[model samples]
Target: MASHRRIRSRSTKPSPAVGFTTAALAGVTLLSGQSASAAPGEPSPSIEEVQKKVDDLYRQAGSATQEYNKAKEAATEQRREVDTLLDQAATRADRLNESRRALGTFAAAQYRTGAVAPTAALMFAESPQAYFDQTRLMDRMTDQQQQAVADYEAQRAEAAEQRAEAGERLEELSASQEALRTSKQNVQAKLAEARSLLSRLTAEEKARLEAIEREKAEEARRKAEEKARAEAERAEAERQAAQKAEAACAPETARETAQPPAQDADPGSGTADGGHAAKADKVIDFARAQIGKPYVWGATGPSSYDCSGLTQAAWKAAGVDLPRTTWDQVEVGTRVATQDLLPGDLVFFYDDISHVGIYIGEGMMIHAPKPGANVREESVYSMPIHGSVRPA
Candidate 1:
């Protein structure tokens, strides 16, 4: 049985990454007209419809939050790259300046020494070899001055290239920052609309909506229990079948072999399954400790977290690093079926794969649900499941 935990009731809200569609606009229109009282002959929207619209808005907001996270992470990485390129450019510029100074010194020394011009030396020489031997101007210049000039040109070109790269990366960072802002705005707008829709409900309507939510949660929980039982039975059956096969082969192996079969391997030998289970325990422990923390969008911290942020932090505690967004986190680790979910496995939700939770057996998951919500344990089936993953 799942342990009882206090689930807080708060305003349900989310952010938006993509713009709302026509259906969303229609929902807004319907919600805008809702109130505690309606005129006779007017049709008020049903509590169920309002509930659904609110849920959809939250889903959209979750999607937008993930996008905001992605953009923010991208901007951080690009900024780092820009800094590295600028540093390289500065170093190259300094080298170029040194080369120029060296060439200037060579010119100053030649002028003070009353050195003859190459052309003058060449004209006065009796032979080509005599010209080269007498002045050694071309040879000496080739050895030092020519090489210094080459170094200066190379350094200048390299510095220009690095500066150009830094500029391009800076532009990319700006675009990412813009995307982050847009996603933030979209999320705020969606949440505002949802809050408005909920606030307009009468006392009776609010009670009805709460009842409907509870009913849905109960149904989801029932389904999850059924699936967990089924999966457990299947696993047991497979294990028994494997054992029987091994037993049947024992006599034949003894008759054919001169030596006895080796004993079973040690469980503590750091087997793959054992290692994964150990890490999973750590991940679950970390997630459990974070319950009741506030859900702050894009935050991955000891104090507060968003959905993906919580998952990333939890796995990081287990010595596994997850990406900053749900989109990327989903791509790592091996995909598993919902029924096969083990404790500490990551279960993603929604068609957009915007939300994620750490599976903690009996179909329950720990997650940072939304803006007004806190990190808490709930049924994985509470939301539509996109997929599950085993991150060892």
Candidate 2:
């Protein structure tokens, strides 16, 4: 592993009697009185600092992954637009060719009739029509010939415009492709830095860090479950209250058997309308199959995925098109409150809205977490909730 020579505190307060080296490589965490080493001999930095640094790097990687996804989406759209323009340009070129052939026939008839002057020729003149009209040569041609010449000129102009538009689209596509490359590199660099930091830790320290993460994940899951239960209970109470009010006001014969309020429609339960249930199930099915696939920064495929890529593909499998980044995806569907998130709703996280996952009800979600991890289910509350959207 590549190591950066970096000086970090051994402790908040170190023994002043010990000698310490000041500098190391860019990412190496040097301890007081001990040079940072990847070998087991180097004294470990505080577990807390290592954990924080790793988490920060992973967050940065997630941000870069979203950037990559956005650029990729733009590039995909730009390429499509460019292709459409190219097709239009080709069609225009064909039209122009046909127009030129019709005009050529007219010039041929005028040539054989000796109506066209030797010096005032149609083929060599800058303004063919003006020259023919000025020399009275157009008088010898049929009305259709005159129209053909005009059509040829108009077709040429239109073709030129189409070609120009195609050129501009190609330029935009090129820029978006470059941006995609930069975003991919940024993600890789951040992940590499995180890996380097992890490599410096001792085996016991690594195990402890993993334990800390597991504990946090469990805690988050517990809290999300608790919140979901509370929302369900609250919704049930409201439904009963409304039913009682209806019973008090209506005649016994006029009253219909009070059915349980539709749980699917309860805003607090985050369930979808019954009509969307089948599609949402399909989305969840696709997402679940992707579990264990490695989380590559910009991938959106059968083998690997970035956060948004996974959700986008899952929904696409269910015949819904989602934008390629969390920021844009959130805007595509109806906004849903956190408590109302149903399966297949996209749950965005973090203040920047850089991360997202597919909510699978019960406060769980399937997501491509970050580089070095795999697609898996975790609590929606595992990270700070920015918002939610139901991309039905």
Q: Pick the candidate with the highest TM-score.
A: 1
User: Local error of candidate 1 at 146, Å?
Assistant: 0.8
Off by over 4 Å in 1: 1-43, 114-142, 231-270
Per-model RMSD to reference = 7.9, 13.0
How well does candidate 1 score on lDDT at residue 180? 89
Provide the lowest-lDDT 10-residue window in model 2.
15-24
Model 1: lDDT of residue 165: 88
Q: For model 2, name the residue pairs that clash.
A: 4-25, 4-26, 4-27, 4-28, 5-24, 5-25, 5-26, 270-340
Candidate 1: TM-score?
Answer: 0.79
Superposed Cα deviation of residue 70, candidate 2 (Å): 1.7
TM-score of every prediction relative to native: 0.79, 0.73
